[model samples]
Target: DAAHTAMWERLDLDIEAHDALLAVLGKFYGDIYLAQEGRLKGAEYLDFVLSEVHGLRIKELQDAKAAGKKIVGTFCVFVPEELTLAAGAVQVGLCAGAKAGTELAETLVPRNTCDLIKSFIGFKLARICPYTESCDLIVGETTCDGKKKAYEAFGEHVPMHVMEVPQCKAPCDRTLFRAELVRYKEALEQLTGQTITAEALAEATKVVNAKRRALQRLAALRAAEPAPISGRDALLVNQISFYDDPVRFTAKINELCDEIEARITKGQGVAPAKTPRLLLAGCPMAVPNWKLPYLIESSGAVIVGEESCIGARNTRDCTDETPGNLDAMLDALCDRYMKIDCACFTPNTERLDNIAAMARDLKADGVIHYGLLFCQPYAHEAMKVGKAMDAAGIPYLSIETDYGMEDAGQLKTRVEAFVETL
Candidate 1:
């Protein structure tokens, strides 16, 4: 602990504030995660990772830096982990889930910026997130207007590289995104001083794709009748995937999925077979953003799948590793990332179809669409999603909230009412 304290101090973190953040996080995790019943034995891995989230993991990143590897931090899933690894960098998803240093964040960005953007700015200004502080380069994307502008302010604080993510899935858009991939590859190459070789990239693709397959396995298992795992636990797995070591995280999650398969075989689950199963869609739930998932599960519904970036949206696709040369590999990367159904895209009918498919495949009774307050894209898509769900003969509930717990009781009441209808 003293060593970590020293490390955090070296990272220039506000030691007092970071310690307080971890203390609160521990109690919150205990109440929400540790208190769950009938949890899979493999969840111990989750507990260990979360426990060491700010300590051992950060230490590892520092060690990698000492070993001459760059640590690349990213907020959105659009950043390619394969390229980061190929360039000999450690890629991590930064902290943006909690409401920290809001006053400071507002000073950096407008008050009306979505909680996700503000949280990252707040984390940086507050000097609380080691992941943000540890970044050698933070890769940002122009996924939404809020983030595009916020990164201008955020760049003043951290070493930033903004990638232009095309807003449409067209031929020209693909060309633009491919060029962006080349730009990012050059960024990583420059930062790490290592040219990304086709061989290295191909290997990295396997590692990243393996991780996706493991998550996909876990997601598929949730389709079982009794639901082999709680939605909160499943969501936790997804959140941890972003921060943990790719190979180690993938192995641990596969072990967890194996446990889930066994549980399903025995018809043993965290919830009753007939519990109202719901699918959560829209917006990513980053680290410690467990409030909504906790409320939904506690209100007597089992979350069968998450269609958000932190959940399915991030894990749903893997890059094509069939290319043998650098140029072709970059194209494969571009093609794979373009498949993401983020609301940032125009004519994102793929998202609507994906949500309906998840609901049907996961055998969900309803869909709970989560939109963070001031998140314009998803908030607008909420109406379209609701109509789509209605036409599909599925019940839906749209919630707009923030990281604060002030509305927990009201949200819980609403969730319970929705569950009753199913």
Candidate 2:
């Protein structure tokens, strides 16, 4: 909400429009969840899945274009929606429909890059997104150096805007954070050819608050029903808010809930299971760990719940939010995202507690920690979490990944060994 308000102050966008847009974005997620719950077998709209996919993101761009709006599409983690809204352009997060990164992994970038980066860049390199050609500008944020360099190099191919992120560790300063926010503001002004006013900021806060409330409602809905949401559907739903028109999107979610009810009545919603349920907790898990869920199920362990950010991070410890204070809002979000995160966070006594709790709740035989080979946080805490799992007599394993390469051969052996021990 603070981010959205910051954008409104900076962009002077129609607040009602953005609120409606976000609800619709979220609702589209609801629809997608319902569709998958029906066992449709693939992500689709009007019976078409992209041959290369672009879900609500495509809708956001298309919808904006139809209204004669100039919408910019860019990489995740960097291009904040506040900037796009403030600049009078809608920012679409580049989550492609087909998600075919393995081919682009062959060339668009070097092999050492993480699969998430590889697949995303490959999607761009392959031109699966229509917005790629039409984009007036592309922007990148400073969340990862990999993205920074990629955007720096790739900027030559399109109009590029980059957010400067200062290194702030262990209690990032509010003053310094504001300075960075100013830089972000200036970069946005320069890119969008617009100006932000103090009055705009106040109004922007209200608009963003509306969107944040919508997000809260989504979390509330997830907490309802026979757990109306699932891990797979949660991933897709989180993304819809990054795109799509909010008004229509809200209506779509209601339609989705109706569909989900029908599926439940038909007994075709939840996955049938015989194995012990496990909770996979850790970082954004879409990449390599997507396979882990299926693998565990195959090995007679049913994954009944998860705390992965890509899975179920929004389920607990919610905040009642309003957005006049940007830094405080960011901290709240960071703290929330940080809390529901996988074991990827710097291992500490707290991370261990999260694991022990999930194990007890899911009645899990063990917890599986999945992360990339070079991931800094997971490397530091792996042994600690292992110890925690052990002390609780809960079985766990830390599997390092380098996406889709046969490094998985070792992983297969390791997983088999872990399960054997269990």
Candidate 3:
């Protein structure tokens, strides 16, 4: 209780605001997750992560602090978690995806900014997020223009480190990113007061790669006919993967995958047989931004996969564990991070190819390319994705919305019509 109290005080959290935020989460979970049928058994573990998102992770951080460790919070998937782990620190995801605190964020940033960025700004400004508060150093990435500038505002209240993410996969570009990675490694070492040795880097690589393998296993099960797990549940697992402890998260996911395997064997599913399968592409759906997936699933369709950072795009790949030294490990990280086909890239043909491959592999009936309002990179790619899908003879729908429920009914109608066409 003292540790908890200290964390609360350290974060300068507004008790009432924090409680109100949790109340919203409770209602959303009850309405969406509790209403699902025959949910996976291991889903409760992830639910626990949400229910105690800050508490449990903060407890881990406190223990790590007692053992002389530091915690790093990151927003983008580009931040090398392995580096943090190697330097004896924890890397927790701090992206705020909920609708809460938007009013507070708007006071700092313009109303027209993307909701994801605004939500995070709000969470920090409102002091309602323990994970954000628990961070010793907040690592931001230059994935897009908005976030690069927004981090300046965010850094006013919290210590910040911004990674210069390269938009193109040119050899020179990767070299730049590799240098950033090296800089990040040095920063982590200095923060944690721990020198990152070759063994430590190799071990961290193994740990992260194992986590990826577990997620990949779970993903493979989703491809089964009838979908052994709901897309909403699968998405929750992916979202939690960012916050949960790596080893524990991997074990729980593998356990869930085992249950899903049994479900596949028994021909059990959350959706009815022959439900229209969907491939959701574009835009990372952070925690509590479950509107589109919930609407799609409840409207007689099953999401088989996603092409976003929160989905297979982040988990499907693994870091090379063969790096025997620090420099080699950084090179591996650079290679792995560069492989991510973010929309920020100049010629992101890999993303389109990934979408088609996901659609074909998962037997998706249609592709719903969802983007958040004001997220220009993904929004701009919507037309290109539509044209590619059209040429490939795949049904596609592009929907852009903010983090508000006002568009729920309209989105449901559009998604339902898309499923019908499928």
Candidate 4:
């Protein structure tokens, strides 16, 4: 394991701490992920990815660096990996799930900020995140006010690029977004010292589209009665997708889908038959932030789908692969990214519509509209979402929480009550 040791050394990562963290994650994986009944095949690969998350990915980055390739770290889905790949650079998702660095992050930002934002800053400030350390550039996006100011503090410490994400989906917003993408592309060129050609962008689009299609297939299988996969496992897959090698990730997902399809054929499922099926909405659930889903599933209901960024919202759309030119490809990226119904958008009917559609199509018995504590956009929009769900006759439960386990007992009581009502 010299290579593994070297990879950590090169990144200045605390190997001992990383191993300890993995040990904790392993126990959780066993209890939460492996404890599920009749699990599908190809899930072992995802386990391996989590076990060696920083080790394997960092080794790949080290090899790429040896070949004169750059690595880009992204915090939001709005930052497209296609452009990074087209520019001959690798993009990895930065750490945002662990609760270890929150105290350090709190010193920099308000303590009441969302844990996801705090986690990222904490990881960087504490220097515990290997992916953040390896990045030649970290791409931040203006998805909300907190992150907008956060990236400012983040920029002072690291080499960063902030994408100006629009709050509305007007024609003018698309124009502005396209221009920002152009600037992003130019920035990538400057960083990589290589011009991204139409051919390169087109090929990268195919790679990313293939990955999205694989995830979409997996999501479709989860809609089956007695869901072929647990919501926790499915969430883990999506979380890993952000960091794993794209081609390998897509292949494994398709393999898992095949196994899941077989499970559905045999009427096998992780949850028992007639379990109350639930759909989770609002706020991205990053890796290691499994409290809500875990509580819900343990309360005798199965999560059929999620309306959050980390779930269907991130994988539901694909870039147009038919775009023959870079301009058209950027247009496609803009269109797809804009289609995401972030709560930050003014008059975000698309989110409510998608939530309703997911609930209906997935045969969900209720919708658990989850929001992280003090996350203004999702918290504010929860009221609107609840009203919409009421009008649509879909039962809704709005839960606002932080990353800590202090609210676990109260959340369990509320969630169990909600499932009983269903």
User: Candidate 3: which stretches are off by over 4 Å?
Assistant: 1-7
Per-prediction TM-score:
0.99, 0.65, 0.97, 0.97
Ten contiguous residues with the weakest lDDT in model 3:
1-10
> Model 1 over residues 1-422: C-alpha lDDT tens digits?
89999999999999999999999999999999999999889999999999999999999999998999899999999999999999989999997999999999999889988899999999999999999888999999999999999999989989999999999999999999999999999999899889999999999999999999999999999899998899999999999999899999999999998888888888898998799999999989999999999999999899999999889999999888799899999989998999999999998998999999999999999999999999999999999999999999999999999999999999999999999999
Instruction: Kindly indicate the candidate among 2 and 3 with the higher lDDT.
Output: 3
Taking the tens digit of each residue's C-alpha lDDT, what string does model 2 give over 134-170? 4666766554555556676667656776755434324
Return the lDDT, model 1, position 256: 92
Note the clash tally of each candidate. Answer: 0, 21, 0, 0
Q: Candidate 2 at 348: error in angstroms?
A: 7.2
Q: Which ten residues in a row have the lowest lDDT in candidate 2?
A: 45-54
lDDT on C-alpha atoms for all candidate structures: 0.94, 0.51, 0.87, 0.87
Q: Report the alpha-carbon TM-score of model 2 versus the true structure.
A: 0.65
| Runs of candidate 1 exceeding 4 Å displacement | none
User: How many Å off is the CA of 11 in candidate 2?
Assistant: 26
Say what the RMSD of model 3 is. Answer: 1.4
**Pick by TM-score: which candidate is best?**
1
